[model samples]
Target chain A: MREPVPEKTFIGIPASDGIAIGPAFCYIPAELTIPVCAAGTVDEEMTRFDMACKRARVELQSLYEAIEKRAGKEEASIFEAHQEMLSDPALEGKVRAEVEIGETVEQALVKATKELASLLAGMDNELFAARALDVKDVGHRILRILLGLPDTALSAVTETSIIIAEDLTPSDTASLDPKLTLGFITAQGGLTSHSAILARTLGLPAIVGMGAGLLEKVPSGTSIILDGRTGEMIFAPGGETIARYKQIKAKRESHLLSLKAAVEKDAHTANGRRVEVTANVGEAASARDAMEHGAEGIGLLRTEFLYLEDTQPPSEEKQYHIYREIFAVMSGRPVIVRTLDIGGDKPPSYFPFPNEMNPFLGWRAIRISLDEPELFKTQLRAILRAAVGHHARIMFPMVSDLDELRRAREIVEVVKRGLEVASVEFAGDVPVGIMVETPAAAVLVDVLAEASDFFSLGTNDLTQYTMAVDRGNAKVSGLFQPLHPAVLRLIRQTIDAGHAKGKWVGMCGELAGMTKAIPILLGFGLDEFSMNPRAIPEAKYLIGKLTDEKARDIAGQAMSFGTAAEIETYMKGVLALL
Target chain B: MAEATIQVKHKIGLHARPASLFVQTANKFSSKIKVRNLTAKVDFVDAKSIIMVLTLGVMKDHEVLIQTDGVDADTALGALTSLIKNNFGET
Candidate 1:
């Protein structure tokens, strides 16, 4: 007689969408322990070291080629740097010095690599610290080859399965095969972690931050069902539960297929009201992809990537070239470039940020831009130069009051004047807008509209500020609802106020692409909706199904409700009707 | 011997890809090349060594003194100086 396995359920933060049902491949990485050994004569040890270096070089060359083929040259450049480090004369000399002192080859390699890693890690800069990790990775790879260990644990996965791990490193993520790796469930990581971002990029369903106990509950080869959209996971599911999830998976796939089929159609209500559907793109490649998915324009082009990677701010020419690349991709479509939004959680290595308790509410974004006039002018000049013969608009972020808007505009004027004097060709009539993220901005939209060309509601920050909930904090994450009545009221107010002043209002947030919120936003008279590139097709398809009058009625009924839960339930009912 | 004192204006100083390029340039000559971080008051290290150049902790706007000695010392000095002056061709 055999006993059946009991069903177990776990919840985590949803990092990507779609459904996955397969056996669990619990990935526990094997740790390498170096054996203590006596050193051979210097000549023999040197030969051994040379052989290992040759092997490591060959391994890195193939790895670089593979990554370049799968990802791109930019991604494979890391391996190029690693190859340089492996052959570095200084690193080699250090190891040789250690071996001459009677240290074993393994010990010499470890000491030399650690010394270099520490030198980089000792720097106060974050970029150098990240480099330290790269050095450690390269060192470990050679160490494994020397020890005669297998390449990696994930390489052994030959069948289709959902991977469950504590967390996946960059190397672990690089090794994942899209065919065999169905999804990922990690015991740790937030929505913006490396693994989570990689999962979304790979179009793989993922749920993260399930806590440390997830690994204990899920053994290898356990039957698993996961919904990345709902962050629901079931282990050792019974037959009934499996059947139910299978239906959900089939329905979602069919729905996606139908939406993608209508990707070329414009987003228009049944009443024939046209609303621009766009994308919030971070780079040139995403901008091109957004256009291919029928994004009307780029509603939000974040300009932080250029500054985040380096130890100092990118030069004016560098910023110009990058902005031009994106503008060229958009091909005369309206591209609203949001100025550098940093500080808070995204402090760059070059800039010294004040240690504050409430960084979100502290000196950030427009505040930093205002204080650093030279840096602000550099970015403004670049944007102006890049906008030549292109449909480019500049938008400021995190503006709470009219003064920050005035001061920023004044600097723009200064940059324009300087460009004219210096004979620099630039677009003179570029529209300047403000992100209505702060409560103060939303409330004073009409007053601020007098000085601004347009308004774009940044609902993510607006919701966080209105609810006073940190979206990243798992404890209060449930409260960070963008569809809440309070947030809806703010959105409604911003749209109406902007319209009254003859300014078009747009929304570039997670709420914009949400299926349940689109109809209500349409009723609220939002001129544009911008979200992730992946969500554009579905949002457009849904918008084409509703009449303006019915959408207004839904919005009106939603407003009558007092709480977020009530509004959410009401929206779900309305969606079912559609 | 040939030498030059130049400020590193590359955004990330003499590190990452820039450091690698610097070492590659130094290795093209038969001259013995060494560099010292004047701003950090660090001693000179072999310029052909990526790890040695990085250990100088040179950052943006930090002045570095480069010295080269051999038949190709002048050529090495010219190339290194031009590389630093051009911001390592990064822009």
Candidate 2:
């Protein structure tokens, strides 16, 4: 058996602001159920109902007064709403009328609870329906307290007592001491729910959907950590996790201090080479985010997302208009547009293709284009039509063999003919490229480089295929090593082959953002590394510190690792040095 | 005038969304459209009464007669033939 919690304990996503340490104890106000004395006189029963109402009002008003005095006018606004709900005219009238008709105070409370629940539930809004449960819970609590029964409110015990419950209504939240309650736990809440939004606004660490039996395992006053980003929980965290976290926290503070200095300066490496940090977006609406995030230009403009919202093919004019918007935001900086890589995992339901035994390795991406010649021709023509007088480097996906590459070129030629006949003002040199995802394509890069102007290594699929492990399959998921020697070898070979054939190569994958892999990729002499926008600053931070010479040394060391854990430890040491 | 009884080669019959799209294509042409599931000649474009087409829900390899008469009836027959043969992208 585990030792009793000496300190108050809480494990949750931290929300609400400020930090205060206090004695660990949970205040479980017992379920308020009044005993039914049915044989009492009618006037006596009415007296009992009035007594209950008086007691509830006094307790509620005391809460309102305390919040108003302590939190001031603005902070106390939430309590005013809660106070209104508690003292609602219809609510008091239901209890009073029930007692007059020979019902005991206990019976009157039960009746009022049901009627209130029904009235609220009848409303169409979910918030209203949810409150139907809340009022009933609160009413039950009040009745139990009147009957002098033990506590019922789930005491969220933290390093002291953090309350864990199915749910806590706003009224329940209003009544609790903000200092005593560390965080909240519930069965249901999305990232954007009112509870979560409020929690973040307040900075209280909360974890939702821990399932049941959490209170039994983690008693009141257990020290714990709530990791919100990765969704991890520490039951009783050891020294290593604590120490490492402390260091990272210090690093974050330092980074914030540098934000102002970095804001005015362009991103450059330690060795004086400037690296373009651009935002990657799926839609043109996210274009402003690029500018806000200090993006030089969009690195990857995923055009496939546009084709997904509609069943019918988007007309050429529609494609042109969307492309024009993306190009317009950049002003002059280049936007690398990848064509529709459909029919793999993202197969459209409207055009249901027959189920494949192995979809990941089946007819997907460029393979779908090869099969549907007309579909590919239409998209190619649309891109050609859209690429008029704009800087757009086009790319194709899943080029495992020479024939697929040639066939893609042939369709591009078809689209170009249409544009030429239509007298469209287009950039003739909007360089065409192929994605090197398959191991075969990576190995045959020299041959591919001759036909294609550039290569974008899609490492997500390449890493999965190289290790013979499905990224989604948990049994072999650990075996799906992103930094395995086998995967790295392919990347190295592809980059070398592209450089050999007078072609520029870039990577569009998670590996580009990985801090350790960033150095390796930079050392490997990649022309560019495209990643999700958020990863830019951190990747740039590492790249800015790393020298080509140092990166090459790290790459050589990484190849010697016998296991993924060893590689991880080695990378951590490298990061520590930086 | 041209007519032919073509078998519903795709596993799912020409119904629902596929049928809706087929009817939309049919309306674009100046042809009297009728699709028969065996002997029941179903009306092409009444979306409300389209369930009658679903009621006969023809399966793969079942033959259904098509009768069309118009200026481009042959073209309609050819286009409908391709859409049905493609399994509406099932293949």
Candidate 3:
């Protein structure tokens, strides 16, 4: 004689698009506790600590192997470093000294790790601060072993269920079992949080920022239905609501299947106009993934990753090999490699950047390259060397005026001459392009196009600079709209200018993949569209349905709209009709 | 005992992978090595200990005094100085 659980519904932000129906697995992690009494003698405590360290090392080895298989070696290196820390004599020596002084093993270990972690945390560097977290994580893992506590509660999920937690850490998301873990619902986090991004990357249905008291309300094992597309969650739903959701889920799955089936097909409009749908990638693995998803080429290959975590600038040989691997993966498909777009938000560890009041508007991108000619030349030399027998092109980021472009081109000429003097083999006919991101660059596209081989509209920065809104700041984020009439006008102007100069125009921004923005960009006669690999199939499918004449009409109407909101609504209405 | 003062020119100083690499290299020879951050003006701690090396807080271009007392002190100093000079083989 059990009372039926009452049906309830909760709304949250839709992070990833999908439908999931499953019982809730309320994940409440067990905290490790230190024993109050010192039960073991000094020698006995030392032995316990030693045994725990040994076990932790074995666990780290396995974790490293698992992570290496799941997410490449670069990520797995963290565990290897943790293993080295566990073997550090100083850490053990500190613990042994504390244990000899009458402190318990757990207490001694905590004190030692805290002291070491604080030393790192006190540094003014963000990378060291992040390492402090790693030190703490390793200490906690050993402490769990010493206390005989089980691993994270996530490992206990044995059945298919929707995970409910306050929030998920990077480690939690990384260890999520794809088969048993259907999706997740979090009481905290925004769309761009680490968990949300990981969920999207893992293709999991997730709804975040569900607010507080969510854990207390939704008990474990309660049958719940969630739509990641609409961000709706139903708890203990009624029969009718369940049926309706089931139908929606079926229809959505079939639609997704159809999109996947047509992934290899070229993007062509109803009026027989063809457009290149490419992908923006950072590394070789992503380039391969993009190719599998039917990316015609790599429109944007961001080169910042090679310089970010290193203790020094990557040498020309190292850069050459890395670029060569990516070129081999792309297999003759054109790759537009953007040279060292560092500074501003992404200052590399090796470089000493001046503290600036306005970093974005200050010395960044091409400015940094032009100032540091040696660093710039090393990268250019690598690109040119790696471009041999590969369809590789070079593109510059954050070009504002003609002076910067002229200097950059002159440097390229210098590098080419230097390579020729050294008898180095390089592709001499590589096309050089400029990213029309700044208002100055967008407005002067005609003049810039004459010097450049092609133009790529970086709408993300275009919107930010044009709207005078910082996209990262929540208060002004609403004004950071790409669909705004002003941003669209800039895009139209840039495309028209590039065409007038007999140069092809491409867009390598988030707007390029958006279903609503595709028709408008098509109407503007953009030659190429580059976006996230996952968005390529749907973008191609949508492009196939729109005629050039109708798309131009829709673009004309969209351009006539006053505000971003009006344009957004109009685009959504237009998308529904197709 | 053999001692030498060398500037740690690695970008991130003695931290993370560099610290681990420094300790691993020091542990190679049968030398009892100790290092102190001359810039930070801290006491010399065991160079073979990653935690001790990290606690020095040696930033880029910070000078560190290394003292090795054992059979292979000169070799250890040469190896350590070369490692620092080469930027921990990160290039």
TM-score of 2: 0.58
Quote the lDDT for A106 in model 2: 75
The sequence of per-residue lDDT tens digits that candidate 2 reaches over residues A349-419 is: 45667688888888888888778877777667766656666677888887899888988888888778777
Scored against the native two-chain complex, candidate 1 gets a DockQ of 0.34
Better of 2 and 3 by DockQ: 3
Tens digits of lDDT, candidate 3, B8-73: 877778976788889999989898999998997878999988766877888888999999989999
Residue lDDT tens for model 3, A256-346: 8868865878778888888999999998889989998989899999999888756689999999998999999999989999998877677
TM-score, candidate 3, is 0.68
Candidate 1: what lDDT?
0.88
Interface Cα root-mean-square deviation for all models: 3.8, 21.4, 3.6
Tell me the tens digit of each residue's lDDT in model 2 across B7-59: 66554455434554555565567876666767344333221122223334455
lDDT comparing candidate 3 with the true structure: 0.87
Write down the C-alpha DockQ for each prediction.
0.34, 0.02, 0.42
Q: Which candidate is the best by TM-score?
A: 3
The fnat score for candidate 3 comes to: 0.67
